[model samples]
Target: MQGFFHGYAMNGIDAKNRVSVPSGYREVIEARSHARIIVLAPHEREPCLIGYDQAYSARLYEKLDRRFGDDFGPERDDAARRQFGATEQLGYDDNGRIVLSPMIKELGELDRLAFFIAAGDTFEIWNPNVLLEVKGASDPRLARIVRAQIEAKGGKA
Candidate 1:
């Protein structure tokens, strides 16, 4: 249930905004008690959709609940609940496709293509071109990090 898929190819998204769960990562997702997932709007700086397996989402909700308590003085707590409560449960359809809501699709600016990237404890959906631009801009730093990691592992990168 623990593995990572990095730098995968940008792939097509269906008209309904369905994307296939990566074949390699499917096993990990299936290991969750509920195949359902929580999809959240990307942060303003990032153009991506975060997909958290059910268990992870529950853990997140619990943390937020504890930290914020139930003080609804200025509806701050209400707002937080609304934001996180908007998460949709996603599952593979008849053809093994995962359906994305319109809000999520729009949030990530997803159209015909989406880049599915593995993240720790979840997966991310990104607009292909935008992700490419971001990745391209950070390639040098990323390469350096990879090189350092390889060196740490005692290998030629």
Candidate 2:
């Protein structure tokens, strides 16, 4: 059986805006999608980026289509635009690094570091400080995790 996303990792983004996907997540993506492709988009309710395999993108399309059911209108159009046009299908290098698009960097507010966390079929890429401020403010466990990452980086996560 294919692996599921179930842990967290934090890595540095290079000057070229490239970062390595955690090896654990890569195993899952490679096994299930049969390639190094990942689809990333701005998360709907979070100031972060969500990434998943191409197959999950198809699943999202199907769900979106079923939700709209051929209703050719603004609401449907808006939803489709967000769900389809906004996503980027990117391939990682043999080293498992992906160059973050300008849009992704801006939207995700990523700087030198990216904090990743698993969420079942997808994973999130977050600007560590922003994540700490926005999410960790309320969730103690998340706060601890981010703080630990920062400490690991000698106060740079």
Q: lDDT per prediction?
A: 0.62, 0.88
lDDT tens digits, residue span 12-115, model 1: 67776777766655555556534634345564357677765666666777776776787656566675665576567777754557777787788778877655
Off by over 4 Å in 2: none
Note the clash tally of each candidate.
0, 0
Model 2, range 1-157, lDDT digits (tens) per residue?
3677889988999999999999898889888889899888999999999989877877888898899897879999898898878788889998899998988789888888899999998999998899988988689899899989978977754
Per-residue lDDT, model 1, residue 98, is 78
Worst 10 residues of 1 by lDDT: 1-10
RMSD of candidate 1 to true structure, Å:
7.5
How does candidate 1 fare on TM-score? 0.71
* TM per candidate: 0.71, 0.93
| Clashes in predicted model 2 | 0
Question: Against the true structure, whose lDDT is highest?
Answer: 2
